[model samples]
Target: MKQQQVKLISLVMVAVFAISLVLAACAVPATAPSAPAGGEAASTDVAAPEAAAPAADSNFKPVWYAPAPHPYFEEVRKGVEAFEAETGIKVEKQIGPDWNQDSQNQRMEALAAQGFNAFSVYPADAVGTNGLYEQLTPNGIHIINFGTSTAQPTTASFAVATDVKAAAMRAAEELIAAMGGKGNIINVLEVLEDPNTALRKQGIDEVVAKYPDVTIIQEVADIKSVEEAVQKVGDALSANIDKVDGIIATGYTPSVAIAQVLSEYKEKGGDRTIHAVGIDTDEMVMQAIKDGVMDGTIVQNPYGHGYLSMLLLQYLSEGYTPKADAYFVDAGFAFATQENLETYNNDILAVTEQIKSELLDKYLEK
Candidate 1:
């Protein structure tokens, strides 16, 4: 009986041990390590971090270009810089060598290749620049004419320049007034290649015609540089000094030249009071006004020209279309004489403010 009891106990113990081994095998994973409590395995299920988005203003690539380096362009450039400072928008600014259409074409094409989509340009040739604009506009590029305009039937979105004809007329009126409405005038013009020169010439001529006594005794044009203008204007003055009573310069280079020449002519004690009027408020010209060597100058809003054109280009770039009737925007103009020299800028700024307030509702289709 005792042997039977011992054997039964031993058999029961062996069965229990076998059952424990089987249960342990079923509870744990046999071949692989288990994942965490609520997620996929760290070693194989990691997700990549998302990339950072690009800056909003970085996509805009605008360029402000002048056909050549001039003091007027330099002042306009100040306005461009002011815009950048105000808006925090960047621009690629350039001034080409000589005022030529071909060079403008080449440089613009190169810039286009580098991904500049907007331009504030002084059109090199009034008629020929349209061909370039045609090419650019088709490819989603925008253009605005500053300082002077391309010819009508143009592809340029807008022109933010002085009314060249009107300004010229004003300059002529000032010159005629100083001449006492009776004198032989010397019409000094800059590059005939520029269409504005022709318009200016016609304005001067029409004004002269109104006063029959004021005849244009000598006309000297194709004055490309200050040096050339000095020589040409000096020659005109020397040749017709006896009869030349009033001098009018309608372009920047010529205006500056006239200021210098007239100042020197006065310093040298030239007896004749050859009254003069010019366009622009060049430092020399302004000084001449102060010295009473010049009668007056037509002060165009070059700062407004620079600031407004850039603002327009920015708007037009962002899906705004020009109104059908919107073309030439006379930025504004004023006659700056010595008497009103200090106050001219305030008047011009008023014009700028008025135009800016109207731009959205009046000029754009949105």
Candidate 2:
């Protein structure tokens, strides 16, 4: 009986052990690995950092250098301002005291030291700017030569200026027409050595040669100051009173002086037979035209010069290369006289307004 009881106990123990093993096998999961408490496996594959965005392009600031202070400089300033307002770029202008080469060089050097990238220069002396070109070009700086052309143009990106020869020729033709194409005309010219002055004289000479009866009574120079010009013109008028049938004053200063003397002469019972043509648009010349003291004057579109200079700079900055020949911009002129003075006065204002609008719309709209 003792042996049978012992066997029963052994069988019960074996059955309990077998059931425990089966339950352990069922509890194990197929998709998940067994984990120790509070621990995780390391990941084999990691993602790279996102790429950084590219930076924006930098802005370019150019400098403008004028030879001297004049009403023309004011027009240039306006054009530069318009460009800056439109393009989000800056044009810093520095006008020299006069047509002094040394003063201009100093200004240029100072600007260069300030790290200016480009320059638009109206050189006082064409030959003198060659050295400047050499110095600036090596520094990766660009240049635009305006108003005057230098001996070496390879140093500059481009040039834009008036057709001085054509305008002067037109002035001569107008004078010849006023004098019936057959009379003695005196030319009150500026410095003869100046390229502009020379071109104008050539034009006058060419047109006057066409009229066989017309002759040049006298040619005067060094009449830069108004007083000096007036004195020279007065002496010429007094000496050749009968032979002088017409007068052509070539520059603004001379034109104003001649107009003043002619006005006084007309007021003091002088004969109104002498016709006059003047260059430049001084108030005195305008008044003379209005009062019929002068027949016509050649007016330069100074504002156009200013506006176009800025445009040329912009084109160059965009990696443009101009043709071999110089770019001559035709800033149209009107023969201002008593017959068309009022009409031209309005036309000048209208054209300036149009230039302003274009500058704003095209350059500033960025």
Candidate 3:
């Protein structure tokens, strides 16, 4: 009986010690910080603790790719960085050497082979990009076109972009207003291959046709680079320097060229007002607006393009599906003049916030 009692005491002691160790292990340390409320991970320059990261699937690898370098792509990258900071999801970003479909296919296929499951790509060729999408989506890859859409009947899950037609029409309206409602316009377009370019041209044409007083006297197309834009736009301006009343560029390269060439025209003592409106907020474009050289610009939400596409991809990884007819998401755009030049980004950001709030209810179905 004595030996049994001694054994029982030893067993009880072991149990008690084990309980104490378990309690200690489960206890929250006094110095350990609590996670931020609402489960948003605190953004910091240093790496976050492993436990702080929210439970995204291990295979939700994502990438952000642009066909080539441009100021607009750089702006879109800011939104991507913001998404990474907010969600703690790393995105691989790549800019190809040229705006070529073959280059994009080679690089992106290699990435897919390496296990990237989601991509946000700016389609180099709207029709050709659909082929790559067809190849990838069947194998369970998700693609979101950030800056523009692929041709219709596409395999891309969604396109987060400004409505090309609407933005072009808005640019046309702004230019006509700047021209005092009656003037000759030099229509500048970029890369003929981009699907957006065709829609933009149609929109501009439609808008111009509505006004009997406004005429598009000269049009320059197929602009590939800033240098090419400068040369072509300068040639157009010199050819119609006397009759051209306003210049409008619906593309980024031509927009930047407009600002540069027009600034030089003013410096060289050209007297015509040459009212102008373009798209995107390049520093040169904004400064031209401030200097009264160019009238204004149509500001597309590139930031929203980056952030919203990634947000959708994140939701997709979380088992959410896009609702029927939710393929073309208009990220929204604003018209920026000298009055709102410095503060227009706030408007764009607000659009992003509004869109973010509506994503679950409006665009996605679990």
Candidate 4:
């Protein structure tokens, strides 16, 4: 009986051990495969937002075409640089030789073909250059005329330069004051066909009309060469040496020529100590003012003219239409004598540098 009981107990213990082993197998958890080393894991979490894209280019080109190679080009170039610096827009300029109408017209057409959207011109002749404007306007190009006016006024943009008439009048008034308000004067004018010259002549006429004693003894026009200018002025001075007390030159080239004649005449012991006053800020004119050869000159800031024209063009491109009043920016001219030459020179240089610095700061990235 004891042997049978022991056998029963062993069988029960074996059955319990087998059930326990099956339960342990069922409780074991399954393991997933590991990701490869250095590989990113797939995540169900939301992704981070992307960075913003850069701005697109406007693709608008601004071109400047001046009629002649003159100081005006340098001023325009500076203004163009200022505009580009401020707006990140590039400016292309073409300066044609004096009176090169055919070349200028051809160049304008070519630039228009190259996708130029705006142009600023100093027209050589009002009648001849109107056709160039007609061509440009049809192409949806903006045009601004500097130093001259157009024959047929169009809705297209135009800047009548600092009251050139006022500038000349101011010059005349200053001359009259320097000569004790009474003197016989010789007026040296630029090309008679030029609108600028006509306006200046009107100013002189106005001032001279006020004082009966201040007579304009001679008016010479179309004096292209300096030699011819000197000859004409010399003859006028010699003929009226006793009567002529002052000389007024209405433009840059003629002014320089007049100064040369006056300087030579003065050295030759001519009795007439001519109080010379001229227009525009050519280097020769400035030097003459410094040397006391010229009593004074009316200085126009052509650099400002170029600078402002580009600025106006940029405004138009940006969809801002100018009010009639804002269309004309009167960049005022100053009278420069030996006393004021240093101040004017410094002011111009400083303004130029400031314009450049402002341009770089506004347009370029640090």
Candidate 4 lDDT over 98-188, as tens digits, reads: 6767877888888899899888777766777888888788767887776566665654476635678898999999899889989788888
Judge candidate 2 at residue 150 and give its lDDT: 65
Stretches of candidate 2 above 4 Å error? 1-59, 152-154, 326-332, 345-366
Q: After superposition, how far is residue 320 of candidate 4 from its true place, in Å?
A: 1.6
Q: Per-prediction TM-score, please?
A: 0.79, 0.76, 0.82, 0.76
Each prediction's number of clashing residue pairs: 0, 2, 0, 0
Between candidates 1 and 3, the lDDT winner: 3
The worst-scoring run of ten residues by lDDT in candidate 1 lies at 36-45
How high is the CA lDDT of each candidate model?
Answer: 0.81, 0.69, 0.85, 0.68
After superposition, which runs of candidate 3 have C-alpha atoms over 4 Å from their true positions? 1-55
lDDT, model 3: 0.85
Candidate 1 has which clashing residue pairs, if any?
none
For residues 1-366, what per-residue lDDT tens digits would candidate 1 score against the true structure?
Answer: 699999999999998998988886675541133321111112122211122212325557899999886656765776676666666788899999888899999999899999999999998888889999999988889999998888888889998899988989989988898888898999999998777788899999999999988899999999877899989988988999788899999987888889898899999999998999988766788889889999888887777788788878888877788998788888988887878866666677678678877787788877
Name the candidate that leads on TM-score: 3
Clashing pairs in 4: none
